[model samples]
Target chain A: MTSQFPSTDDVILGPGDDAAVVAAPDGRTVATTDLLVEGRHFRREWSTARDVGHRAVAQNYADVVAMGARPTGLLIGFAAPADLPLAWAEEFTAGVREECALAGGAVVGGDMVGSDTLTIAVTALGDLEGRAPVRRDGARAGDVVAYTGHLGLSAAGLALLERGVDGPADCLSEHRRPSPPYAAGPEAAVLGATAMLDISDGLVQDLGHICRASGVRVDLESDALRPEPALLEAVRVLGAPAGNAVAAARRLMAVGGEDHALAAVFPPETGLPEHWHAVGVVAEAPRGSEEVPEHPVTLDGDVVERGGWDHFRRE
Target chain B: MTSQFPSTDDVILGPGDDAAVVAAPDGRTVATTDLLVEGRHFRREWSTARDVGHRAVAQNYADVVAMGARPTGLLIGFAAPADLPLAWAEEFTAGVREECALAGGAVVGGDMVGSDTLTIAVTALGDLEGRAPVRRDGARAGDVVAYTGHLGLSAAGLALLERGVDGPADCLSEHRRPSPPYAAGPEAAVLGATAMLDISDGLVQDLGHICRASGVRVDLESDALRPEPALLEAVRVLGAPAGNAVAAARRLMAVGGEDHALAAVFPPETGLPEHWHAVGVVAEAPRGSEEVPEHPVTLDGDVVERGGWDHFRRE
Candidate 1:
């Protein structure tokens, strides 16, 4: 699609200049950035250039939505080997354009450089429409913790792709391109979310951020999760330990990242969306607490291990 | 120094959420980004983490200043091997903070990720107090071209470092940390510059950008350059070709990138600062000519080969 604003008109000053000036509607702007490396973030064999671009935009946009903001524009930096096909670059831009459309934003500008491997760094800008920013430090004791997006779906999809599971093609696709519940973040804020975060890491890990920031503890009820049954099928297909499967799903719900799900703690009285589930409640930390509980999710009436991905350690 | 605003107060929302909201003065923001890779941009053996941080901030902030904007904040993304030292990260942050202070800005937020090699991506934000952004396309025929900031110094230092020629340690240090004429950008803008650009990609190459964009041609009188005598000393020490010294200097002026100098074409009658010199004049492209001149700058009354760095074929 053509740019929403003419190249000359949309940008008060275009890309060749030092900095770009974009129209800020509400006198406030929201900004976030993410970097994607070639082999580490994506392998050409597993993902097309378009897939890479889509994933990049989706993840960053997820962050904006999680803040209850609407994405406005994006600036991308791409580094690639000299030998890479020019077509790949064109396709990548197209993917960025498509994802920006999905996220209600535009690809305003970017820089391209030569590298031995391909890397993409993306910065997203957003608008809050004068609403107070919802932060992770505001969850209080007695708040209801709710999640508005897929829980273990991305993790399950990743497992299926890794183990070569054959049941559902869509699961593998989801692993490549996550469909975050973008609208849910702002909706949660509008509904009085006290604290919020994007579940890019894992459900538990991200909620843990809210817990630590807000100085509260979180308790999750496994039965309340809607995606458990679907995840179990993949667990069974992989013939993995049932405990590991449950832990993976729980950890993802609790720690699995990259889904870009928006999890928030709101006043207990606040109503939640149809897809959102009240998996837990925020409470004051217990006295003499030495460690945060890993498996806060109770399965079959017992707590289990919730091991999720960690950037510095093997998953 | 502690943050100017409390984490909760200044950030409105700290980093845990999807995006961040910082107060934008007068509802206008200046944004620019740059990516620096480990080997491509700098070698660990040649510079410390702190030096890398300073260089990264300097180049990006130069862009902001090049636009006649006052930098206010920066967001950095770092990708490094998992085993990298924590102290190195801290030092890097300190360098960024130091340079931000120099530019009158703060390090607002950033992201860290694990990668096979180190890469630092910086996005700088600035505020222009109601001044129009100076662009490269604004020059017209008969505009006088002038430069503020050091030229050929970094290139001279690079030649010494590349050839392993020992010199006063300051030359190498200058190469590692260029002191851009930060205030000159807006100064030129306020002085009624017709068009302006940062002299990062060598004098001739950068001016070429202005010429190509402004639909004009540039003619440079090299005898007017002030640093020629000093550069000749470094050239002699490096044992570069004797007949090629002038050509080399012109090439360095033409295509040399990364000096971060400010170059602008001003109205012919405009007075310039004492340090600023009349390097060239912009003129209409010659009739029936599809190609620009082979050498945009005439060195000592002769045309010379102007070659500068291109990432794809720099070496």
Candidate 2:
């Protein structure tokens, strides 16, 4: 009201009370949030402001898709240094708008604050169109675990970048920007997936979430992983320790995060699309097992000793 | 899901999707978000981690109330250095929990990441039951402007602290932690407030927002403001620049922000609570005015310039 901006009737109570009532015409709403920090979550040297913005929106929207919801709107809170370039901010906003459009959503409102470093926080809202949310705790003992979208590629690319290895541009591109299988989440839900999640943090770690939530053990077959060859080739080219690379790739496929691929557990006999590969199966925990009740799937017939990324532990 | 956490049915879809869906039994949800950055927003020396947590929740929740909604839940995204004490993090969460209880909400979810400095982002959700939102774009000519909650105390306290003027403990408390009139927001909405907003930036600037949005001009009668001898005494003690304490009070009541006071425009004949004071009137722009419109109300028998905090141009 301080400026000459035209007021809209839709904002019944704009900037005044306990909550802004956005008209949810469909009667159901979906909500997800993501936070991006300087250095830790992103590096200005590695990614441009636009790239950071796109990455931020893509990851959060992937979560919305994982929930089987159609993203509708987003609210952003941006914190940055007072001296930051105004153009950076503008381009960042443009990136968000572009990514939101890709995810079929609009940026509704945002707050900007001056901080010492750049940080972007985004909360996305969606509409379910009346479908029940598919949860991670619904996988049964006999469910077949399948995945949609690329795996190991992000981890392989990350390894290549970290080791300063030059590779085909594809590897670096994969590390810089991830293309999540956005539509596959709701599609899986409609396909009768009992339980599903987005593969961020690596396959093993993410699937461990489903297993622990569903109280089941999982057995993975290594032969089914087709991306291993490409990953191995990248690992060989990097000349870095192949132990961690092989282990990390398989581990990331099992345990690494940020790729944001869709993974779901469906009935054993459920038909899957070509993009989805049968990677594992759920099983009852062995009686009186000394290990954790939910067992992790093994790679190349070897049981993975570690779980996914733990914030408390240094990588 | 990786940790030993309880599974709740309330979290229909947790942590995997672009957005999470929760039950909204009332068919309406209230929402607001805020960003608090280190150095710019708060100095660690001036506030403890717990204080930061409390302030973050307090200010955002106040916005929710300003919308006339009941706080229900909150999701927080915290970015801090890895070396930040575990105890500090615990205490910070405790503070969030304490404020949530005070505002009648729960800390439903959050994201934590490592950053060079601490930053907190909070998104609060509320339920409106079934009431219309009171907006700032409804004030009409001849409407009486009133305010609930303390005004200028924060600015006064801040000025004292900035000048290193030793004051009574309560003055520092006001500067450190503001107690916004949370209930007044919904109360004003129910009372049929034509235009309303929380006085966050400053009374004058915020009112200017309402005026611009509602297409009206506001004029404050200086004599209507009560005596502020305490502020005068403090200003004198600090050897601050000379200004009418009453005029400053009037200006603060008009422009200064961060007090989070609720100001509402009502029909001139409407009855107000004992604590509420009628300070101004809403009217059309003055006649024969090229810049400002006709019908501008005379403040203290003269026109007063509008001023307040602007983040981009902060002093």
Candidate 3:
């Protein structure tokens, strides 16, 4: 039967066929998969099906970008109750298409199944276009650490949402739809990034992943990482629930998850790209026989104790 | 951290990396995804976690093969409760690796999340090696229809399982683990098969999908589609509660789901590959002035009325 699904340039073969065929110019494919379950990664009362679909694609797309690759296609698996409205499914697909278009990608194929609770799984495929993949283990001591995109906005959004703050709450919207720095990854790679990762977890916590992978310590300058004025305004709008808005903003910036910003380490002599913020520096781990530092991530010489979200934790 | 996971040659890159890199020699990638949820697709009391994992991969792998491609890599997303035993997760991954190896593929990457119930989402990738994909719309009126792999075994096994039939039950075992004929797909394509598809939703029902897509009628001969003795024996073991065991076997062979068997249409001049059973023929739909046949599939010249499993049905 003829399909009503939209088609795009990247998808040589689209949905309705047994499988999709997509172009891979570089002779290699970069792929990643992520799953989001209702009540765990999202809540129906809090997120519309459209919001959930956008969020799922946004996060998985970030992973491919973190590898310094351009997304080519997406394969999605959605399991929802049979009683779910057809309108919800349509809107969800629209959201998926919207996000894919934003990344210059296409939804090539998908599967729908009946389940008791809603679940969405997305797999993104990308092409490196002849560039080497930027891995988390390539960072070296003395490299500069930089980031692109907003940091603690999503976390502040969540706080405002929880507090039932009235009127326009940009943080709440940011929480529902994370716009990751898609182009920044490939740009960083072109600019000779030593190592890279996406900040799905908080800044300090995600940088710790880089440190552990590269066997180096990352030191953030507190002055450089001070919460942005927008986040401080959000704190003011929330009426300073934490009693000290600046400290609360700092804590949120360090430990809140799901921002999906791009973070990378570059050689000292490399020219930093526009909009890239230099926030930290990579250092060698303590030598043998020397005491290990209390933290792999230090802010202005102070060890950070709070970490990012752990799904396995009992809350 | 060092991985305890097993490795394979097909994997250019493996888990724990942000994303995986797999070879695509033909400059194109064939991809498909499927989702299986607990209680909906499998019962924990009936199938082990390992069995569930194998079934999930087998089904998704069949789709890639149906497109006349060689399976390359798989990306899996699993969500389950935090209280789930670590052993369950390990066994599940082992099952995935085992099935992928059988298909000459590898488990390249995956994601894990905490949820109330178990859900497995798998996306399979493949390389066509420069051959044109055999789509379901390419079947012609004079082409011969063929199928490879077990037909009614899984359904008969389900029946025996539901009846609590004791004694040797190979059909029950088959239901727990599907083994699709992966090699036959590329072979069929090489032999110039016209159109192809995998029989995950019974013989007649799935053939109807091909018929609708190709805009042609498909005719199955009863003599050519006789159920294997093993499946008939299963019907006998269940005591033919619905009456004639032979008739029950015939219906099961025509309407059972989840078999993961490969079916295709080939030109009459093309020599049929070994292991591919010729079971039917393609025919033209009624003329322009005439009304289309009520059924796209015909059994021994009679229209089939019993449909296959529909997940969205209230029943």
Candidate 4:
């Protein structure tokens, strides 16, 4: 299905035959799959066909980049209703093409099918370039938690989109077409990150994942998490992010989803990538404390409750 | 998402992180994707969740094998309605695990999402073991076309199921959970096979793909393609494969879908792997033919019109 596209240097064999052969020079491949369903992940009314495609590819690419790998190619599975206009597909794939190029990858292959609902399944592949993967289980007790990129702009955008109010163009555009920090992945790996992941399910919830896997607690510095101005404004407009502007700003940054920021832990005193800023500190649970903390993630001294998009329950 | 599965030998990093790291020792990876949509690819009334999972994995595995590669891992994207039974999801992934084991691979990672329609997107990855991929464009004029599995059992089973008639259990079971000749893939490359692919759409249409890519014509020997007794019986009961029983059997063999048989072109006089049967011979188009054959596939020197399942056109 990818035969129409010109072949790239990394593609040893392009699509048209039974399968595509991509160069994996490092002798290992980093692979991840993501699903985007119409109405659930994106609404046609809220996003242009190209925006939908960009968001889909961006989400999958972040997964690969978070693994400290260089993107190689993608195997996409697109299913849609028959009545969809041909222009929609063209624009969507065009978005896929452009976004993939940004990641130094190609659309290696794909399957197109028909269904009652529009759906997209993207499997992003990457080459690790011979580095040991930065896993969630590798964090040390004294590591510092840092994040690169916005924390809640996507959530802010969603708030505005949901209320049919136009405010900050940055938030609105980002929610429609997210731009991930793809380069930060390998840079963090080189900088000796102990644990890392893409922030898709909000900073608090995602940090909790790293803490649970690494057997530590991630305590955020509330001062460092001062809500971004755009997000604060979006929260003010909604008046419902948390029932009040200040609380809503904090909650929006805490649990807003789909920003695809890189959240990573580095050894104490280690220098981080320029764009990365310290957000929290990783520590063992208080010694001799009768039980583990209720929440793996905490802000200042208080546990943050879990709140994020629930995919299945939303149905 | 695949963290619960026991780690396999080929996996360097298991799922739990943003992505999976799979061993690709040959410096390149073979990739292919296939989508199975509800109502279009399978009917829940006719197939168990396990059956659906098996069929989906089988099709993707065939594509990788056709590239003369050894299966390494699979990344699956599964989406279904919120009301779906939890047992259904469990049984479905169980089937994915078991089927991937057949090709010496593991379920490395996957994404689960909510959608109005049940959809599955499977991407199979493979290691070529350092051999050149067996592409369709490599067939020589004197090569003999061969096959290494049943060609029409799945199609026949579909016919029987569509009519709600009692017929061959082998056909029915195979249609639900195909057991492709995976070993034949690497073995064919070792035996100097020039071109190969899995017969997903049909022998005729798929071979036509090879013909156009290789710039050669494949002329079949009628006697070599005698209809299988089970397929013939199924055709007799259905009375719809074609107008007449014999013609129906021939059409079923020529245009059947989902059988996923391995078809290859081997140099003349090359000894084939055990169980492979020679069915046709590759040849150049006759001198001064004004145009390419309308259909690259021919039977007894006559063209066979195209017939195969089309994914998008169904809508």
Candidate with best lDDT? 4
TM-score, cand. 1 vs. native: 0.87
Better of 2 and 3 by DockQ: 3
In the range A1-315, model 3's lDDT, one tens digit per residue, is 114346667788888878999988877889999998888888777777778778989999899999999999888898888898888888788778778778878888888888877889999999988898888888888999999987888877776666666423556767898889899989999999989888887888888878888888888886676777777777667565556767656666777778888899999998897778899899998872133355788988788776422211222
TM-score of chain B of each: 0.86, 0.83, 0.92, 0.92
| Candidate 2 CAPRI assessment class | acceptable
In order, the candidates keep a fraction of the true contacts of: 0.53, 0.51, 0.86, 0.96
Q: Which runs of model 1 end up more than 4 angstroms from their true locations?
A: A1-11, A228-232, A240-252, A287-304, A308-315, B1-17, B83-87, B168-170, B228-232, B240-251, B287-304, B308-315
The deviation in Å at residue A156 for candidate 4 is 0.5
Model 4 DockQ reads 0.85
Give me the runs in candidate 3 sitting further than 4 Å from their true place: A1-5, A238-247, A288-294, A307-315, B1-5, B241-247, B288-292, B307-315
Write candidate 1's Cα lDDT for B172-225 as tens digits: 666788777888877887888888877887887778787776767787877666
- Full candidate order by DockQ, most accurate first: 4, 3, 1, 2
Task: List ranges where model 4 is wrong by over 4 Å.
Answer: A1-6, A240-248, A287-292, A307-315, B1-6, B239-247, B287-291, B306-315
Q: DockQ of all candidates, in order?
A: 0.52, 0.44, 0.78, 0.85
The most accurate candidate by TM-score is 4
Off by over 4 Å in 2: A1-20, A23-28, A228-236, A239-252, A288-295, A305-315, B1-20, B23-28, B227-251, B287-315
Which is superior by TM-score, 1 or 3? 3
Model 1 Cα displacement at A136 (Å)? Answer: 0.8
DockQ for model 1?
Answer: 0.52
- Model 2 chain B: weakest 10-residue lDDT segment is B1-10
